[model samples]
Target: MRAIVLTEPQAVALVNDWPDPEPGPGDVVVAIRAVGLCGSDLSVYDGDRAVPSLPWVMGHEGGGEIVATGPGVVDRHVGQRVVIEPNYCCFDCVACRNGRTSACDRRRIVGMNDPGLLAERVAVPARFTWPVPATVSDGALGCTEPLAVARTAVRRSGVAPGDRCLVVGAGSQGLFTCQTLLAAGAQVSVTEPHEGRLELAEQLGAKRVETAEVEPFPLVFDTAGVPAAWDTSLRAVAGGGTVVMIGMSRSPVSVSTRELVQRQVTIVGSLIYDHPTDFSATAAAVADGSVTPEQVLQAGSHPENAAAAFAKAREAPGKSWIDLSSWREESA
Candidate 1:
């Protein structure tokens, strides 16, 4: 099997002789078809995001076909098309028991804690695999993970039909958030410093696209983790409204407690998706054309050129994907 290994910070290597994955009980081996390079991948590559370990295979947003199943895996079988959920939770945790799997006491992100989908094959727990409709392309299916995150953010915002909402940033996750809000019948507005990304946001159903300055919205989502965007989001939400923080930011910034108290603002930090619900909902949205994946994924690179793929992802306004099947031709 061929895998792209993040050998060290700012280094990526494509290794052709990586051992193939062997599934455990209740697991299945998936032949990865398409994998999207994420902003987190860039963070890991640049040493901005600390991982549990290094030299890790670097991808979690992917979809593929099931090639084999391990013992006790009955419901999923060979030849099934599926998207990887990526978040592995400890089912015994109190949060998991309460059906809040995203908040499980011990959760392992696939690429960060375990081997990721940036390879020819990956072994994932059957429970973490969701069957995707054939109507969706492999590249589109690869986007389900991020779309799930977007859906979770929108759900946490409590935005209702015809409500005014603002999303800060026009990156892949931000654009997906905008579309999710639009699907929920919210009047969406987006803020992006980049002109091209701002236009892309409008195409993704944002009714208003502005350059970082905007009126107060009843609901606001901060998908850009920069301090300025955070400050803008905090100030952009109307009094008594809600703001959801979906982007990860390591730097600390000061906030006005008095403002929050006086205005009665609701602030929430949304993590990854809720296992089956958010993942399934995102897949359904993709299949139904409610959230167009192509709008966010603008290009694809062969996994053999994994480094180039990462570079494209870093520079491109949209998401960059890796075609994992390309290794077969190279090996042949």
Candidate 2:
């Protein structure tokens, strides 16, 4: 089996003799069809974030079809197209019991700490995989994971129909966040340095600003994941408002305790997303045309050039995607 392995920091290798994945109980072996690179994947690659070990597989956002099922799996079947949730939580954990599975005591992200799907196939827990409509393309399905992240940020903000909101970046995450906020009936505005992204933000129904210098809004979303973006979000949010952090920046930033306390600001740290329900909502939104995740996709690369695909991810204006359908069960 061919797999793209992150052999070390800032380096990746294509190994044609990589070991094949085997499905365990309650798991399914999926013949991967597509993958989307995320900022967090770059963080792991740059050694800005630490996983359990090295030589790790390097993609998270993905979709494909079931090729084989393990024991105790009853719902999914071979040949069913689906989107991979990537994150799975232990049901018996305290967080799961309290309906906060994203914070479960025992949770693992498939492509970060564990083995990833940047390969010909992946064996993922059946509970973390969701079936998609037959009409959904593999590229569109691969965009589900990040879109789910955006949806989670909006849902966490608790914005009402008329609430004014500001998103601090116009990247893919920022655009998706803006679109999700609009779908929730909130008035949305965006701040970005890139002219092209700001235009795309406007096309997606968001007001544009050169920076976060205008009037403060009741809710602010920070997708830039940088210290400056965090500071700007803090300043752009109205007193007693909420600022949701949606990016995966590892650097530390200074904060004003007095300002934070005086204004009664509520800061939230949102990660990937919750299981079942969050993905369920995202898939539904994509299906009904309430959200268009595919709009953020860039040109895709085939498996033969997967290493080059990752090399170009950091520079892609939109979501960097890889088409892995060549390795589908039928093709394999």
C-alpha lDDT of all candidate models, in order: 0.83, 0.84
Count of steric clashes across candidates, in order: 0, 0
Give the TM-score of each candidate.
Answer: 0.95, 0.94
Error of 1 at 67 (Å): 0.5
Question: Following a full C-alpha superposition, what root-mean-square deviation does model 2 have from the true structure?
Answer: 1.8
The global Cα lDDT (0 to 1) of model 1 is: 0.83
Candidate 1 lDDT by residue in tens digits, 152-199: 988877779999998998888898898888888999998888777777
TM-score of 1: 0.95
Off by over 4 Å in 1: 52-54, 209-213, 328-332
lDDT of 2 at 103: 90
Q: Judge candidate 1 at residue 265 and give its lDDT.
A: 92
Q: Which pairs of residues collide in candidate 1?
A: none
